[model samples]
Target: MTNTAATEIDDTSSAFTPNLTIDVGGAPMLYRRTGRSSHTVPPLVLLQHFRGNLDYWDPLLLDTLAADRDVITVDLHGVGGSGGQTPDNVSDMTRNAIAFITALGLTEIDLLGFSLGGHIAQEIALVRPRLLRRLVLAGTAPQGAPDLHRWSEDVYRWATGDVTAPEDFISLFFSGSDDGRQRAWEYLARTHTRQQDRDPESSLACRDAQFQALMTWGIPESAKLQRLSAITQPTLVANGDNDTMMYTKNSQLLAENIGGAQLRIYPDAGHGFLDQYPVQFGQHVRQFLGC
Candidate 1:
């Protein structure tokens, strides 16, 4: 188990010292920033996958984004540094996220969300369309909403002491990419330190709350395909070719649904598309931002 604290590059450094908490709406949330770009250029915010900690974000990839814009990567409510307190679930997560940005005093910025984060990003767009300059949805889906029922149950069991069958838990999140399943498996192996006190149990509590709150997540059930017209921001929808969970068609569906939204499908990618192809993914994001 790698602590990764000694060499941690993304969270804190003398250079990117953030004020930790912000008064967004009513919730005081934790967020980190890096790079020194001025207000002339908008900042960038990142939303990671299901139960993703800020430390879990691949450092090299974050540094890449940091070079171009001030980047904000947050641990969503009930996960990571921000997971203290009651979130109510992903629905509340959406509300808290908007507050996180608003509290930071950022009105317009580029937003990127991966996997579960993508779900939150979409909900935010619905609630506060004007707050975003652009929106990027990566390795996520508009459907397959509660298909996580069993997965959530598994998380509950795993958290309570059942060893997470790493393969079953992880295979669904990968898409065969530049490195195929081997690389995906290897990266997961390297990063998978059982955090014990801070491991899956706490996360499952949040997921259970989210599962219940999903009943009111406000994501369209018939889930209107044309709802993207309401989003007044340039959008990029992308995913890996072999994402087992959301699949490529989901990305296509989002792009097709959202007005003027562009779709980019990677040749040998999985749900961890950005991690598998960081350079290419970063380049694509830069292009989308018109940088």
Candidate 2:
């Protein structure tokens, strides 16, 4: 963990830094920007997991990444504080994300995407190759990977249920061991630190649409893996060794397919390894971005 004292003194650090909105195609996108903007370093734009909003991010992880450069997080359209109905497919979602970036007047950025967000990030790289300087894919898989067309019954129940309990999240994201559960509780507490002005919880519509997109992306087609060859940006692929949601093997597949991409798999962790190993992952990301 980063020193709390240092984070407190830095005005632009932490996840509680303030929510701001920008209009993209007449709809609003809720977002937060942390750390001072740098001319030399492209801002790190974060894309969230399935059903995640701005408040879903871990404060400690955000602060650690914000130590040296700007970090940005946004709610997907029709989710949380953002306006407009959610897109039901990856292509529309990719366009929505691209609109948000261009609306910010940024031509170049470093993208860090998790789960469903990682899928969209790949689309962005392929569609707008010049817009990204680097890419970080965590707990995600390439399109059409086998055994991903639909999640197992247990995961589907917790993930798409109308309400998600603490136990559900812990079971879905963290390892079953004692230490992993301890870290899961800590991560949950940190996310709830923001007392006011927090982004609203994700809606049912958002959940349904995102799950449909995931299912569509997971339909098996070996040729879809070939699409990754066009993503030539410096890439970092990482995940927990026990990711029940996306599965650990997907992360390995990503590293093997993307040319020159580096891979990291943290042991005794699950889908939420970035939060479980926040400090180490943050350091790795900072080093990769070269800020």
Tens-digit lDDT track for model 1 on 4-84? 332433234322334365555544556667766755568888987655566556545566677657888876556655545
Q: For residues 148-210, write the lDDT of model 2, one tens digit per residue.
A: 898999899878889999899989999989988888877787777676798999899999999
| Clash number by candidate, in order | 5, 0
Q: Count clashing pairs, candidate 2.
A: 0
Score residue 175 of candidate 1 by CA lDDT. 51
Q: Top TM-score: which candidate number?
A: 2
Instruction: Note the Cα lDDT for every prediction shown.
Output: 0.65, 0.89
Clashes of 1: 5
Off by over 4 Å in 1: 1-19, 23-28, 83-90, 143-170, 176-178, 185-202, 213-220
